[model samples]
Target: MFHTAICDLLGIRYPIIQGAMQDAGGPRLVAAVSEAGGLGVLPTFGGTEAALRADIEKTSKLTRRPFAVNITPIGRAFTESRAAICIEMGVKIVTTGRGDPGLSIVEKMKAAGIVVIPVVPSVAHAIRVEQEGADAIVASGSEAGGHVGRVSTMPLVPQVVDAVKVPVVAAGGIGDGRGFLAALALGACGIQLGTRFIAAQESEASDWVKQRIIAARETDTIVSSLMTGKPVRALSSRILSAYEAERARCSDEQERAAARGRFLSELRDAARDDRTYAAGEISGMIRGIAPVRDLIEAIINDAAALAEKLHALAGRS
Candidate 1:
């Protein structure tokens, strides 16, 4: 009942796309999501090309269903190299995030018959990617984890849908059936989930990070550039809280710079030990780690039931 254009375009039973998570979403998580009939995406950020190939190979071995590779366009060379690898590996669907990957990269993928979907943050970005030959667009809002933009999902999805002829998938702060139906109501053809997937049993995320997500409140996440040099939505930490608090009291530029360096040092130390991980605001809503298949099926089933309730309400009104 929730079937949408993305289902037809991606050859999936459902219109759910697991948002590309770098370290957290490896082959196991990707393949699990695919096997459950949703589009699973492998992330190409913070890993080597060799790792990407191995992940794709392993995912192929795990599931006959289609999956996607997301290339974080950090640079022209990085983008081109990742696209080349995807083409070489015969990946059918490709999702690009972080920044615009340029026309040449999109063309390269399209030439290989790969469906290109760029996660955009605004209407202008949506139109730009559509003009650049993107087959579809994922409108990611600031409420998402990792790198984010200024717009929130509620307004961003519909604007992108109106701005582009291609299908738009709503992302950010979407964790359950209500969010699923809301995305469709906002004119999105599908939904892309990030934080919720971090708690999937197949996720490679550390157990502590998973626990943190389960314990988090919606207000626990703060968008701080300190983590990745870009505004990344992550759970608040004492180091970050110190940085933010220091941001307020430091009168001298030198003091602020010194504090920034200290926070970064602590952040690096924490990250090296797997003590830190990025997660979306929706983490607050997630309660436990379940298999990827169960999570996806539950979301679809709950959405169908919710739609019926809403329809009945409308009839009564």
Candidate 2:
């Protein structure tokens, strides 16, 4: 019912997007969200082109609704191949991250008639993406899981919305209907949530990972660059502590590089074992995992009720 420019552009029923969490946002989660009227995005970070195609096929089988693929431009060749796969699979939308999706990439996708939504962390990034012909921009704040910028959603969303002419999707600590309503009030056309979806039953994350998020409080999640040489928000754990300690002991560039490499290796191992890594402060607000359909319904129902109350208050005034 909360349709906006984003929902119209992406052909989704609601202006909600499930942030593509690495290793967690796979076929099941993507399909579930799409089937529930929200746009779900599959993260294409863990597999090859063939694997991505197979996952896309499986997701198609699971849900007749539209879905998207997220590809962070970490390595040039890998990202290029992933983009090709997305196009080949007839993906209606592609979310780019980590780098500037240059004109060429945007042009190629656009020529294929695919909607290109780039994730930006600042007003500057949003402007740049808009100029590059992105169909929309997802303004991710520091409160978001994984690599993030310095600004939080409250200020960042409006700034990005004002900076770009294209539709803006707010991303970060948003978890529930209140967050979604707040985003709309801030001029955002849509909301994308990561941590909230991690707690959903369709998420690929392990049960232990979900339990950690459920038990965490607002202050429990920390933002640190010790893991991947970039600022990322995640749960504070023994591994993070160790990585911090090692970084502190290394003063020279060479020592720091070696320490960072070691930390990254450990993080990769943890990801492989289905351990929790990236999470947002919204974890504090999460109670338990539910089926994707129920989760979406609850969010919409709560949002509708809140809107009605606000409308009644306006009449009284």
Candidate 3:
């Protein structure tokens, strides 16, 4: 019941894509998602080429199913280098985020017969990637955990679908079967989930971060650039709030850079037990940790049931 064009496009049993979360995604999580029939993606935002190669090999050994590598274009060299590794390692699918992964990189992947999917924040970005030969697009919104744009998913997905010829996947503000079905209704071929997966038992996120997600509310998250010098949405904490306040008070670039460094340090040390991490608005919906397979199955089963209920309602009208 959950099968769609995305499933065919990505060679998966279900039309679901696990977001390549930098902190929570690893070989274990990626393999588990792929084993459960969704396209699990490994993050390479701040990772090295050696790390990416090892992760691909490890995930391959863990599961025979398909998975992907995400190249967050933090720099031109980083993006191009990671793409080369993916090609060298024979990785079949690649996802890109943060910004354009560059036309040259996308073309290289296509030339190698690897599928390229780019996560975009707007219709304009979606159109550009399509022209650059993207096989699919993930329309992530500001409500997402990591680097995000100003728009939310609801309005962003359909506009991108209308603007681009490629398949569109919806991300941000999604955590369950309800959101899964909603994305399909909004013209998405599938759904990509990040924050929800962070609470998975296979996730690499720390206990503190997982517990924070379980206990969080809708308003508990804030989007700040302190972590990566780019807007990232995460659960708010004393350190994050304090940094935001300091950022407001900084009189010069030097002071702001110092403040940013301090915030990152607190995060690195897990100091004060108050360091926060990326989490989407969906944090409020997560209540506990479960196996990655169980989580993916629940989304598919629940979405199928929900679709039937909606069908019955529609027939009545």
Candidate 4:
């Protein structure tokens, strides 16, 4: 009953998309979301073509439901190879970010009958994605977890929806059913969430990371580009503070670039050692980790109740 254009296009029961969180969205998490009727996407930021294929295979073994693979073209020449692997593994959907999904890649994926959705932060980016033949667009706001842009969801979603003809999925600061309903009101066909899924039990994020998110307050998050060249929202920590200090000392572009590279290297090392990283301000809202199925059930039930209240208001009008 919660079906929308996205669900119809992707052959899923719900219109919720698990925003491909780096390192957290592994095979188990992806399959769990897909089995719960939401479209789960495997994050491939730290993986190779072979690793992505293996994750797809494992997800296949866990559930027969439809799912997707997220490809972030960051310092990699594996786009074509990864796209081919998705096609070979019978992946019905592919989500892209970090780089422009070139026309050639879009054509190849469409040729293989894959629904391509690109996440964009602004109306210009959304329009560009539409021109590149993306099947849909996810308008990600600055409030979302991980790497983000300047626009917030409230204004960005409607702007992108009006600019592009394809279905728009709103992402950022959306962790509950109220947010989903609000997105629908804003003309979005579906909603994508990252912070909420980060707290899901099936997520591969370390326990320390989850606890940090759970213990955070709404005011504890900060948006800083000191990690990479792009603005990212994360919980404030000592590591981030050091990166911020280094960034402040750099007055020239060259110095800033070097400092950024050093910070990125540190983050890479931390990830390898299973260290904790944070998400957006929504981290404060995540109190505990639950299984993917239970999370979806709670969201659906809450949405249904809200829908009833809206219907009653319409009757009064």
Candidate 4's TM-score: 0.93
* Local lDDT at 155 for model 2: 98
lDDT (tens digit, per residue) of candidate 1 on 167-204: 99999999988899999999999999999999999999
lDDT of candidate 3 vs native? 0.91
Ranking by lDDT: 3, 1, 2, 4
How would the candidate models be sorted by TM-score, starting from the highest?
A: 3, 1, 2, 4
Q: Would you estimate the TM-scores of all the predictions? A: 0.94, 0.94, 0.95, 0.93
Of candidates 4 and 3, the better by lDDT: 3
lDDT of 2: 0.87
**Model 2: what TM-score?**
0.94
lDDT of 4 by residue, 194-229 (tens): 888888999998887788888888877777786556
Where does model 4 exceed 4 Å of error?
Answer: 261-278, 314-317
Among residues 3 or more apart in sequence or in different chains, the pairs in candidate 4 whose N, CA or C atoms overlap within 3 Å are none
Q: Per-residue lDDT of 1-317 in model 3, one digit per residue for the tens?
A: 67788899889998989999987999999999999899999999878888898899999999999999999998888998999999999999999998898888889999999999999999999988999999999999889998899999999999999998888999999988999999999999999999999999999998888998999999999988888888889888887888889899999999999999988887788764677688999999999999988998899889989999999999999
Q: After superposition, how far is residue 56 of candidate 2 from its true place, in Å?
A: 0.8
The whole-model lDDT of each prediction reads: 0.90, 0.87, 0.91, 0.85
Model 4 lowest lDDT segment of ten:
269-278
The worst-scoring run of ten residues by lDDT in candidate 1 lies at 268-277
TM-score of 1: 0.94
Off by over 4 Å in 3: 250-255, 265-272
